[model samples]
Target: MSLSKGRISLIMNRNIQKIFLLGLLVSSTAVFSQIQEERLILNKKREPEVKKIEKKKTSVETIKNYPPEEKSAVPVEYEITNVPAVSDFKTSTIQGEDLSPKFDSELQKNYFRLGYGNYGKFLADGNISGNLQNQMEVGANVHYISTEGLKKEYPWSSKQSSAALGGFLTSYGESGKFNLNAEYNLIDYNYYGIYALQPAADVDLSQKTNQFTVDGYYDFYTNNILNDARVKSSFLGDKFDAKESNVSAMLNLSKHAVQLPANGITMNADLGLGIETLNSEFAILNKNYSNYFNADIAPKVTFFSGNSYVMLGSSFSFLNSKNKNLLTTDEVKSNKAYWFPKAEILYAATEEFKFYAGVDGGLKMNSYASMLQENPYLVSDQVIKPTETKYNIYFGLKGDLNQNLKFDVNAGFGKVKNILLYEANGLFDNNATLNRSAYNFANTFSAVYDNGNVSTITGNLQYYPLANLTLEAELNFASYRLENLEKAYNRPMVKGTLGAKYTMLDKKLHLGFKGFLMSEKPTNSFQIVETPNPNVSNSTIYQNVENRNDSVAGHADFNLSAEYKVHKNFSIFALGNNLMTQKYETFKGYKVLGPQILGGVKISF
Candidate 1:
C-alpha cells in the first residue's frame, strides 16, 4: 500500500490525539483515587442522632385557657416585632448644582478646559486647541551573526558581523477640528565580509544596506461625517545592489452616531493605489531580468456583526518592463487580477467556552518563469511560465475554559498550480535539464505546515498557584513526508518548552527560568552523477539520505530584572538575560550568544 503525504499527516495527528487522551486518563485516575480515599475516611467517623422531649405538663396548663379564649374570641389580636423600619437607599438631588464651589475657578482653568472633559470632547477640543506634542527615540545595538557550521559544509569559512544604528522621531498636532501625525525612521546594516571559495579562487565579499521610511496621517470630522487620509513611503538600497521603493496613500470617510446600538453592525470599505519599482545590476545576467515597475489599485470591504463577519478584497496590478535579456527581450507587459473572499462565524456557548470557524480563500497570479529568471544562481537555461493560481480552505476552533486554561485547534488545506522547481547539470553547463535534475519544473503540492507535507499539533497549559507567579508549558509535534524519487519518506519533529516566573518587590522585580527541548530527523536529498554514464540520459540519480544527528537536546535560561522608582518622573533599573550562561543552540548548528549584562535609567513625564 502506498501512503500519500496527506494521509501520513492525518495518521500523525491521530497519534498525537491518542497520546493526549492517555495523559488525560492518567491524571484523572490519580485525582479519582484521592477523592475516593477521602470519602472513605469521612464515612468511617459517622455520628449518631438524638431524640427529644415530652409535653404532658403543658397540656394540663392549656385546658383552662382554651375555654376562656373561645368566649372572648371576638377580640382582635395584633402583634408587632421590634425591628427597624426600612429606609430608602436612593437619594434625589437637584441638577446643575455646584457641589464644590471653592475649587470651581481652578477646575475651569486647569481641569475643565484642558483635562477633565469627556474623552471624545477632550480629544476634539484639543485638536482645535492648537497644541503640539513631539517624541523621539534613539538606540544602538552591536550584533554578531555567525554561520560557522554553514561555512564548514561549504568549501570555505564564513562569519556574519553587524553593527547597527537606528532611531525614530514622531510629532502630532491639532488644529481646530483637525489632527495631524507624522513619523520617520532610519536603519542601516553593514556586513563585514563573507569568506567563500569560488571555482576560480577564495574571496571575501562585503555589503551594506540602508532603509528609510516616512509616514503621515490627518484626521478631521464635522457634524456627522468623518474624514481620514494617510500617506506612507519606504526606500531601500544596498551596495552593489538594486534599489527598491514603495509608496502608497489611502483616504477614508465614515459617519458618526450619537448613540451606538447594543447589537451594532459596521460596514467599511477602502480603495488604495500603490506603486513599486526595483532596479539592480544583477538583472544584466538574465535579459528577462530587468528593472520593472508595477502599479496596483485595490478595494476592500469588511462587514462586522454580533457573531459573524465577512471581508471581500481584490486587486488589479499592471506590470511594465523593458528587458535587455533574451528571455524578457520581448517587451514584457502583463496585467494580473487577484481576489480574496473570506468569512468567519463565532458562537459563545457558555461563560467559559466559545467556538469559532472560518474559511478564507484567494486567487493569485503566479509567475513561475519570472521567479526562476530572477535567481541566476539557481540553474541555467530554465524556462519559467507565468500565471499560476492557489486556493486555501480551513476550519478551526479557539476558546478558553477559564482564566488559566486556553486552547486552539485548526486544520487547513491549500494547493498551488504551475509551481516552479529547479534541475541542474554539472561542470560547464549553466542550464537546468528536467532529466538531469531531480526537480526542474514548477511543481504543486498541498499546503501543509512549513511548506512541507506535515501535520502540526500544538498546545499550551498555564498554572498559577500564587499571586505574581506563573508556570507555563508548551508542546508541538509535526509529522510529514519528504518526497524523493516519487516516494514518500516519513519524518517527525517534536519540540517542547516549560517556564516559570516569579514577581517580587511589589512587582518591581522579576525572575524567570525556561527550558526547551527539540528533536528531529531530517531527510536530505541530493543528485549524484554516475561516472560511466556521464553522457547517458539517466546519468544523474536522486536519493534520500538520512541524517543521523537526530537527538534530543535541552537547555535552561535564567533571567532577572529589577526596577526602582527614584521619583514620579525618573526611574533606574537593572536587567539581565541568560544569567546562567548555559551553552545551547537557538537552532540547529546555531550557538546562542551566552549572556548579556546591561543597566540603564529611564525618565518619563
Candidate 2:
C-alpha cells in the first residue's frame, strides 16, 4: 500500500513538531539536574582546624633541616642492530567481489582544449571560413551497484567488474567548400566475473572480459562539398572461466553526405574475422554441444535522395569444428551467405507537418551454437542455418504548432521468417539454455521454431504554456504474433510529465517542481509465462493470474536551489531533490526511496 502525497506531508509535519518538543524537554531536564547537584554541593558544612600550638612546635623542629648536595648525570650509549630485511614474497587469497584495485594511474589528470583561429571582415569582396581545434579528455570512474530481491535463496547478483583506462584525442580543421577531420580513441576495458542468474542450484559461472578499441576517421569534400568517406574498425576479446580467449575484429568503409540531391546518402562495406581457442574443459562441452569456430566478410551500400533511399548488403560466413560426438562437429565445415536490401521515403507536406515510410528486408546467420557451448547440454546438431528472410515497414509524422508546441507520431510493422531459436532440455543440462541468455529463459531444450510479426505505434506531444513551464506526454502500443502460435499479444505504455520553474533574487535562486506519471502492462511473453500452464496446447491463452496492483505509479519531485557568488571563481549553493517525500514503486515489486537533500560549494575558473 502507498500513501497519498497530502497524507504523507501531514504526517511529516506532525513528526517534526514532536521531535522539536522532545529535544526541548531533554535539554531542560539536563539543566535542572546540573543545578540541583551544584546546590547540594554548596550546602555541605566545612571543618575548622585548631592547630596554632602544633604549628609553632613544628616550625621550630623544621628549622634544623639541612640541604642536599648536587650530583652530575652520566650519559649511556646503546648499540643499534641492523633491522632484518622483510621478506618480499607474500601470499593472499583473491576471493570475493571487492578484491579489485580501487584506483588507477590515469585517474589523476586534467584535460585542456586548445585552438588557433582567425576571422576577418568579408563585405562583398570574398567569402572564407576556417578554424583549427584540438580537444582531449582523460578521466576514470568507479561505480558499484548491488541488488537483492525476495523469492530467492541466493540473491541474483551481477557486477559491472570493469576498469576502463583510456582517452581520446582529436583534431579538426574546417574551411568553406572543404572540410577535413581526424580523430583517434584508444580505450581498454578489463572486465571480470560479470555473471547473471541461472536456474542451477548452488552453481555460479564466471567470465573474463576485456576489449581494446581504436577508431580513426577522416573526410574530404570539394565543389558542392556534399559527400565524404569514412572508415572504422574494432576488436573484441572474451575469456570465460571454462573457455579460452575468443577474439574478433571488424573494419568498415563508408561514404557520407548530406542532401545528395533530394536527401542524404551513406554507403558502407565491412569485413570481419574471429578466432576461438577453447580450454580442455570447455572443449569437452563444445564437443558435446556441437560448437564451431566462425568468421565472416560482408559488403553493404546505400543511396539516398529527396524523400527516398535504398540499401543493399550481403555477407559470407565460414564455420569449422573438430568433434566426433555431435553432427557437424567432425571438421564438416560449411559456408553460409546472406543478403539484405531496404528502401524508404519521407516527405514534408507543409511547414507544420511531415510524413515518412520505409521497408527493410534482410537475412541473418546464426552464431549461437558456437557462442553457447559451455553449458551442460548435449547438442544433437551443431550447424544451425541462417534465418530465411525478414522485412519491415514504417511511417511517421512530426510537426510543430506555434512556437511552443510540437507533436510526433510513428507506426511500424515487421515480419520475420525462419528465425533461429534455441531449444533447451532439462534444468542444469548444457543444452537446456543458451549460456548467454540473461534474465529471459524458459524450460529445457525443446524443438525451437521462430517466425513472428510485430506492429507498433508511438506518439509524443510537448507544450509550453509560459517561458518557464512545460508539459509533455508520450504513449506507445505494440502487438506481436508468433507464426507457430495462435494468439497475438498487445502491450500499451504511457508516460506524462508537467514541470514549472521560477527564478528569484536576480535569477540567482531558482525553485522548480516536476510531476511524472508512468504506467505499463506486462505484455511480454516471458512475463506472462509466470502463470500456471494452460490446458490448451495449440492455442496460446494468456490469463491474468496475478495482479501486483502497481502498474499505476507516479511521483512528484520538487527542487529548491540557491546559488550565491562570492568571488569570480567561487560560489556556494544548496540543492534538494524529491522534497515532497513521495513513495512509489519503480517495477512490479521494487520500492523506490524518497526525499534526499544535498548542499555543497563549487569553485570554477
Candidate 3:
C-alpha cells in the first residue's frame, strides 16, 4: 500500500508502539517468574525436613554385614563388710491358770431357780430347752409361786403353779414351719375383802382356778412373703363349787391376693374367727350363764415404695351372745355386727427418723377369766361382754438418736364402748329371807360396763452408754371422759417407769433397778346397813351405801435386783421390792405387800 509521508510515519510509530508493548509483556512475565521462585523457596524453608528411609537389607546380608560384638562377664571383687541390725522386740512366756473347759453362756439351756422371801413367799422356776434335731427344738418350763398374807390375820394367801411345753419345727420346702405349745396353770387365791366384816373362823375364803392353753401355728411361705396361719385355744375353770368355766378359741389366716400397679405393693387378705363362753352359777344375778361368739374378716392393700409404706383395709365382725336366766327358764339372745376401718402409713424422712400414723379399731372380749386375772378380788357375779374400740388414731416419731440411743413419742385418741370397770358390791337383803350365806354375802367387787372416750400421749427412750449397760424410761399420760359415770375408775392419768440394767465382769454379774409411778385415780367403796322402815312392812330395810374417791393418792415403787453368776450354770440372785416406799393400796381396802427381800440360787445347764 502507498501512503503519504505522514501516514508512513504513523505506521512506523505504530510498529514501534507494538514493540514497546511486547517488551513490557516480557518484563512482566520475568518479574512474575522470579516472584513464584521466591515464594517456593520461602515455603521450602518454612516446612520441616522429611528424611528418606532406606530399605532394610535381607536377614542373611544384614547378619554378614553387621556382625555382633562379643561380650565377657566382668568379675567384681567383694570386700567383706558387716551391718548391725536392730529390733525393738522382747519375747516372754505367759503363764495363766489352766482352764481345761471354757465356760460358754450359749451352751446353757436349762435353768432352775429357788427363792424365799421374808413375807413367807416361796418361788420355784425351771426351764429346759434343747434341740431335738437339726430342724426341731423342744422346750418345757415350770414355775411354782406361793405367798402368805402380809399379816397372819388377814387370811389372804396366794399360790400358783404353772407348766408349759412347746416345740418348734421347721421345714425346708414351701411348708415353712410349725409351732405347738401347751400350758397348764393352777392358782389359789383368797378373797379377804372387807377385813372388818370377816368372820372369826376365817371361813377359808379361798378359791382355786385352773387354766389350760394350747396354741398351734403353721406357716406357708413363698419367697419372703409371710402368709401363714395359726390357732389358739384356752380353757379356764374357777372352783367356786365347780360352777365357773371359760373356753376360748381363735383361728387366723392370711394370704396374698394380687399385685398392684406399682412395684412392691401387694393386695392381701386376712380372716379370723373366735368363740368364747362363760358358764357360772351366781345366786345374786338373774342371768348367770353367757356365751359369746365372734368372727372377723379383713382384706388389705399394702403399698410399699421407697421410704414410704401404707396399708388400707377394713374389718367386718359378727358377734352373738346368749344369756340364760338364773331360773334356767328364760333366755336372752343378742347379735351385732361391727365394721372397723384400718389404715397405716409410715414415712422415713432420713436414715435415723421415721414418722408413722395409723387408725385401728377392734372388739375385745371381756370374759370372767380375764377379769379375775386383772382383779383377783372379784366376786362370782360378773358380766361377760365385748369392749368395742370404735376408732383409735395415732401418730408417732420413732428413730435412733445415735448408734446407742433410741426414742419414740406417740399420741393417740380413741373411744371405747362397754368398757369394763370394777366396783364394790354392797350386801342386799329381802324382807322374807335373812341372807348371811358366805357365797351370797361375800365382800368382793364386781365388773361394771360403761362407755368412755380416751386420749393418750406416751414417750419411750432407751440408751446404751456401754456395751453392758442400758438405761430405759417410759412416760404415759391419758385422759378419759365417761358417758354415765362421774369418773373412770382405776384409769390412771399418768404412768411412768424408769429402769437401768448393768452387766459387769464379762456378764458374770447383772444389776437391775426399776422405779414405777402412776397418777391418782378413782376408787369405789360400798357398804350395806339396815334401816327401820315404818311405812313398809315391820321388817328392817337394807340401805346401800356407796362412796367414791375421785382422787386416790398414787403410789411409787422401787425395785432392785442383782445376780452374781458363780459358774456358767449357777447363779445367786437377790431381789428387793418396794425398797423405799410407804404402805399403799392399789385397790380399795387392799394394801400392797410391804417391803420384801428375796434371795435365791439359780442353776442352768
Candidate 4:
C-alpha cells in the first residue's frame, strides 16, 4: 500500500510540471508576437518602403524596385517635435555721428576770393564747379587784377581780367580709360612793360585775348600691348587783330615682347606718331597770313635691368610752312624733313647714388599767338618760324641725403637753330629813317632769330624736416654763343631762386616766401647826347648810341605772403611784394612795382 501511494504522488507531480511548462510557452509566444507587430508599425513610419515588380518574359536585369504607393489608412497619433524659429534681422541707429571729424570727405565745389590794398590795387577771383553723377565735371572761373601807378610820372598802371569755362569727362572701363576736356578763356592784358628810360608821354596799350581749347585722350590695354591716343584743338584771338588756330594729335603704342626672369630685365618696343598744324592771321603787320604743319614719327626700344636702364630711339620729323604778305602780295613756302636720334642711359650704383646721361632733340613751332603770349611787349610786326634743336647732351647726379633732404645737380650742352629772342626797339631812334622797325616805336619789341649753342649747369636742393615746413633752392648757370653775335642778349649768366613755405594750425594758416636773383645780363640801350655840330653853330641833334658798361649789376626780388583762416571755408590773406624796395628790372628796363601790399579774403563752398 505505501509503494502504490508513492507512485501516484510522483505521477501527479509530473503532470503539474508539464502543465506549467505549456502555459509559460504560450505566454512567451503571445508577448513575442505583440512586440513584432509594434516594431513593424514603427519601421513602416520611419523607413522608406520599396516594392519589387516582375516583368513578363524578361531577364534578371528586367526586374525593378519601386517605392511604396500611397494608401489611405486609419489616422494614427504621433509625437510632434518642437523647434525654434530663425530670422535674419538687425537694428541700427546713428545720432550726430561726429561728422566734423569726417569733414575731409566734403567736396569744395566753389570758391571765391577778394582783396584790396594800397597803390589802388584790386583783386577779384572766383570759381564755381559741379560734379555730374561722378562721371564729369563742369566749372567756370573769373579773375581780375589791377593796380594804379605809383608816384612816378611814367605810365605804370596795369589791369588784367580773365574768365574761363571748362568741362572734364572721364570714362573708365575694363579695357582702359578715356578723358575729354573742353575749355574757353577770355583774357584782357595791358602792356605794362614800359617806363624804362623815361618815356616822353603815356601811351595807350591794352590787349584782349580769347582762347578755346578741346582735348581728348584714350589709354587702352590689350594682351601685352598698351596704346595711348591724344587729340587737341585750340582757337585763339587777340584784340591786336591776330587770330590763330592750332590742332595736334598723338598716338603711342608699346609692346612688352621679351622678358628675362633669370636676369631681372625687361624690354619694351614703342612707336609714337604725332601731327600738328598751326594757322595764324595778323592784320596789323602789313596784313600777313602764316601757316605751319608738322608731323613726326618715333620708334624706340627700352631696356630695363636690375639697376641699369637704356633707351634707344629715333625720330623723323617733317615740317611745312607757308607765309603770305598781303601788303607786298608775296607768297613764300618752305618744307623740310629732320631726323633726330635719341639715346639715354641710367645706372644706379647704389640707392643713394645714381648716374644718368641722355641726348635728345626736337623741333619747336612758333606762331604769332605763341610769340605774343611769351612776350606781351612784342610788336605786331613779327615773323613766325620753327626752331630746330640739333642735339642736347645732358648728365646729372641726383640722390637723397635722407627722407627729408634731396639734392640734384645737372649739366647740359645743346645747340638750337633759329632760336627766338626779344629785343627792345626804338630806345632813342624816334626817327623813321634811324629806327630798325619804324612802325613799332612806342614801348614795343621785335623777335630776332639766331643760331646758337648753350651750356648750362644747374643745382637744386630741397629740405623738409617737418610736415608743415618746406625749403627749396635752385641755382643755374648758362653760357651762350651765337653765330654772329658778341653776347647772348637778354640771357642771364646766373640765376637762382630760394623759396620757403610753412603751414600751421592744421593748414589753416599758410606762409610762403620767395627770393629770386639774376646775374647781370647783356642788354642794349641808347642814351641821347647833344653835341654841337661843327657846320651848324649852337644847333643840338639827338642820336642813338649803344651804352657800353664795364660791369652790369644784377637784380634781386623778394616776395612774402601769408594766410590766416577764420573758418574752414573762409580766410584772410596778405601779400607783401618787393619787400626790400629794390627797383629791380626783369626785362631790360621794365621795373617791377616796389613794396606792394595786398590783403584779401578767401571763401570756399
Candidate 5:
C-alpha cells in the first residue's frame, strides 16, 4: 500500500550500491593477507613481513672417481754385542701371602699347646707343616710330658714320663738337598730307689721301668766327592724283656787335592767310612747282656789359607766284643785293634775372629747301648769295655763380640783308659760271703773301670742388649783324676747354664728365662742286712771295699716363659718350671719333678 515512496527510495539506492561493493572486496582481501609487503628498492626503507616460500622440486645424480697406489718405507734396527759378568749375584726376598680366608696367616706357623699342673702335671706340644710340592716339605710333631710323682711327703715312688712323635720330609732339587727324619719315643721310670729302704716294703714299684724308642735319620749331600751320606737307626725296648738295636753308617769322600790362587794355598782330602752294630738282650733282674761290633777308617788332610785351616787325621779301628753266658757256660770274648791320631787347627784373626786347636783320640765304644746312656742304674752284668782316648787336647776361642756379642772359650786335656765308675751294690762287704746277688740291694749300681785324667774349662756366651733382648751363658769346669776308682764317683764338677730372651708388646710380648747349675758329685754307699741279723755278722759296714767315699748334692734349675699375643692365630702361655727348684737330683737316688707352674693356649693354623 505504500509503494510510492519514490519507488521505495529507488530500492534503497540499489541496495546501497551493493553494500558498497561488498565493502570494497573485504577491505582489499585483508590488506593483501597481511604478509606480502616485502619489497624494497628506490629509497628502500620498508622491510618487515617476509614469510612466503614455495618453489618447484630439483634432483641431480652424481658421478664417481677412484685412483691410487703407493708403497715405500722401512726402518727399524737394534744390535749389541756380547756381555756377561757376575760370579754370583743374588737378591731374593719375596714372601707375601694372605689370600683371605684368614686364620692368622703369617704362613700359619703351626702350633698347639696344652698344659696342666700341680703334682699331676701334663703338658703337650705340637707342630705341623705343609708344602707338598714345589720342592716338597712336610712335617708333623708332638711331644708330651707327664708327672704324678714325688710328694707324698716323699718316701719313695717318684715318677716320670716322656713321649714324642714325629715325622718330617724335605726335598729340594736342582741337584741337591734331602732330609728325612722319623721318631717315636716313650720312657717311664720308677722303682723309687727300692723305696729308700722299703717304706713298708710291699714292692710293686709302679712302672718298674720302661723305654721304647724308634728313630731313623738319613742324610745325603752333594757338592761333589760324595760329600756326605749318613744313615742312623735305633730301635730300643725295655720292660723286663729287654731288647736293643742300633745301626749306623757313615761315608764321606772329598777332594780338591790342590788349588792355589786368590786366597791361595788350598789342598784338601777326605775319606771316611764307619760302621757300627750293637744288639743287646738284657733283663737286669735276670741278666744276659753285651754284644758289639764296630769298624771305622777315617782319613783327612786339609790345608787352607786366607786365614788358616789345617786338619790332618787318621783313625782306624776294628773291635768286637761279646759276652755269652746264658747262665752256666760263661764265655766272654774280645778282639780289638785301634790307632788314632787326629788334629784340627783353624785360625781367622778377623772376620769376627776365631782361633781353634785340637788333638783327638778315640775308641770309646762300650755298649748295652753305651751303658744305657751312662747309667740308667747299670747292673745286669756290665763289662763291655773300650774307653781309651789317649789324647784330647783342645784349645779354642771363637768370636763375634760386636754385633751383639757371641763368644766361646774352651780349654781341655784328657787321658782315659777304662774310666767308668759307679759302685754300690752291697758295697760287697762279702754280701753274706758273696752269696747275695739279686742286685744285693744297696739299691744297685756297679760298673767300675778306672784310669783317668781329665781337666776342662769351658765358657760360652751370647748377649744382645736390646733389639728384643737376649742373653745366654754357659760355663763348665771339670777335674777328675782316677786311677783305680778312688773317687770321681757321680762325676760332675761344676756346670752352669743360663739363658734369657725378651721381646715387647709390638712383638706381642714374649719372654723366656732358663738356668741350670750342677756341682756336688761323688756317691757310693751300702748297708743292708736288717734285724738282729745285723750284729750277727758284726754288721757295721758303713761303706766297704776299704771304705768307698760318698757324696751327692748339687742342684739348681730354673725356667720361666711367657707369651701373649691375643690373636694372629691366638696365643697365651705361661710356664714356670723348677722355678728355683722344688726337686732336683741328676740321679743318685733319683728325684725329679719340680716347681712346675702352667697355663696354656696357642693355636695357629
Candidate 6:
C-alpha cells in the first residue's frame, strides 16, 4: 500500500500503476483503531477538484507531517497547495506508525510533535496560524530532523537531515479565493551504500542540497462552468550544481445536464516550461540536459444511470525540447506529440458488489525536484526523461462482503515509452582524466529509462472484526518486460502494508502497529579488476567490472506505537520502528536506522 514511503514516486506510473497505489489508500479503511494522520502529495492526479500540488513538508524529519486530526483547521486543499513538497528518501529511521490521538470535533485543530530516538535521531514539527480578518489568514510551519549513520556494519555513514521550513497566507474576497506560500529546503546527506562484498574508500560520504520554492493558487468561484484556474512554479537544485526550474498554469471546467446520452462533461488543460542543467560524465555517455516546453489537455464526458456511471475521455500532449547530442558536443532539437485514452465504466449489478473497468493513461514529466525527492543520492549528470503511458486496461470487483469487511481486486497490463528505474551508477576506470561525480563509486543511484510493458495484480482489504478494532492490508504484484535493461532495478515484485489499532481506557489510551513489506529486489554490482598494461611500466592497469547482476535480500520492518491523552490539549506517545530489527535498506545499499525508540509529546492550542 505505502510501498515504503521512499518507494512511492518511482512507481507512480498511471493506470495499472495508479491502481497499484490507489488500492492501498482505500484499504486503509479496513484497518482501524482510528487513524489520525493528516497528509498528502505522493499522488496528485486523484485530487483534481482540489488541484492537489503535493505538499512536501520541506523538512525530512516527518515521515508524515501535519498530524491528521489537525487537518480540520485548514481546508485540506489549502494545506496541500501551499506546502512545497515532501523531503527526499534520506535513509530515515522513523517509518513508525502514527499513534497520534483522535480527538472530538470540539478540540483545537493545531497539532505538534517532538521526538528523539537512537542513532542520534531528532525531529520537531509544528505550525501556527491565525485568522487576520474577515476571510484572511496567515500561517507558518517549522520542520527539522537529524539522524546519524548506521554504526553496526562497515561501509560508510548514512547521516542526514531534512531541514526545511516556511510560511503561508490565504485570503477570500467577494469574487474569489487565493493562497500564497514560500519555502526553503536544505538537506545534508550521504552516499553510504557500497556492497560489503566490494568495498571502496570511505570517500567524503557527505552531500549538501539547497532548494527554494514560492507557490500559490487562485480559484474563481463563479456562475459558469469555467470556474477553477491555478498556477505553480518551483526551483530545485542541489550541491551537485544540478539546477531546474518549472512553471505551469492549469484550468478546470465542468458542466452537467443540458445533454442527451451524456449528462456531464469536464475538461482541464495544463501548460508549462522547464529549464534544466546536469553536467555530463564522459565515460557514462554525455547526455546534455534538455530544456522543454509542454502542454496537455484532458476532456471527459460522463453518463450516469441508476447507481452506475460511465465516462469517456482522452489525453493529448505536445512537447518541444532542445538537447545536446548524446556522446557528442553537437546540439539537437526535437518536437513530439502524445495522446492516450481516458475511459472508465462502473456498473452496479448487485447491492453488495460492483463491476468497474477502465483504460487510463497520461504523461509524467520528470524534474530535478521530483527525481531527487524520489532518490536523493542520484548522480548529478544523470538524464531525466518524462514517462508516457501508452495505455493500461483494467477491470475489478469491489463492494462490502459484509458490513464489517470490504475488498477490491484488479489486474491490468500496459506499455510505457519511458519508465524510469534506479540503477547503481556505472563504475569508471581509475586512470581516466574525468573528475568523477560524488555520487559515483556505486554508492549512489542514477535514473535510467527504458521502454517496457508491465502487468500488475493488486488488491486491498479493510475489516472491522470487533468494536474499537481496525485492521488494514494492501498488496501488489507486478511483472515487467523491458526493451533494454536486465531487470527493473530496485523495483520489488511484491509490495504491501499492514496496520492494526486498538483503543482502551475509554479511548484515552491507544495501541497501534503498522508494517511495510517489500520483496527482494534485483540490482547492479561492481568490482575492480586489474589487467597488464603494455603501455605502462610494471604496474598493472585497473578496470571497473561494472553492472554485474545482484540483489538485495527481501525484508520487512514493523513498528509499534502507544499514546495516552494527558489532557484535552496535550498527550504523550512512545513509538518504536523497525521492531523486528530487520536492519533493512530503503534504497539499494543505504540501510535505514532501525530498532529505534522515540518518546514525544503532542500539543494543540
Overall lDDT per candidate, in order of appearance: 0.31, 0.31, 0.53, 0.55, 0.52, 0.57
- lDDT string, candidate 5, 1-605, tens digits: 00000010001122221000000010010101001110100001011111111000110111111000110011101111001000000000000000001111232236676766666666666667678866666776666656656656455445555566666665644444455666675656444554224443233444323333333332222324665566666676655556777777777776653676755787778788988887777655436666788899989887877556787898988988787645747768788888888888878788466777878888866555445544555555555566888887888776654445656677889898897666656533433333333234355576778888888877766565565565656667888888666678877787666656666776687666655566878877654443333455655333333236767687665666677879878877776656664454544555555455667676777
**TM-scores, each model vs. reference:** 0.47, 0.43, 0.74, 0.73, 0.28, 0.78
Model 6: residues with Cα > 4 Å off, grouped in runs: 1-112, 172-177, 196-202, 218-223, 257-287, 400-406, 432-437, 464-470
Better model by TM-score: candidate 3 vs candidate 5: 3
Candidate 1 — number of clashing residue pairs?
A: 11
Query: Of the candidates shown, which would achieve the greatest TM-score relative to the real structure?
Result: 6
In model 1, how large is the Cα lDDT of residue 547?
34
After TM-score superposition, the amount by which residue 90's alpha carbon in candidate 5 deviates from its true location, in angstroms, is: 47
Which residue runs does candidate 1 get wrong by more than 4 Å?
1-163, 167-207, 215-232, 248-332, 361-389, 400-407, 416-502, 512-605
lDDT of 6 by residue, 1-605 (tens): 22211222211222222111111231122110111121211111111121112211221111122112222221121111111111111122423333332322212235677887776767676656677986786766666666665666644555666666776777765555676767776777766666523434455666776767666666544413554566667776656565677776777664443235444432222222222232222123353476767787777666656546677888788877766546656666778888888887878696467788889887777775666655666766667578889998888877654445556677889988889888876464455322344555566677888999999887766665655565767677888899998799877798776767667887788776677667888888676566777788876755667654788778776777788889968988887766787767656666655577878887878
* Residue 52 accuracy (lDDT) in model 6: 17
Predict model 6's lDDT versus the native. Answer: 0.57
lDDT of 4 by residue, 1-605 (tens): 00000010001122221000000010011110000110100001111111111111111110011111111111111111111000000000000000000011121236677877655666665556555645344455454545553437244334444455555555544555566767676655455544223333344456677878787877563413456688988898777767889999998876753686747787768788999999988877556778999999999887877656788999889998898876666688889999987888878686456677888888987766566544555666567778898998898876554335556677889999987776665543433222222123335667778899989887766665665565767677888889966776666788776667676777677676666666876756545444566666766544555553322358675667787778878878787666777655545444445566778887877
- Candidate 3 collision pairs: none
Per-residue accuracy of model 3 over 64-91 as CA lDDT, tens digit each: 1111121011111111111100000000
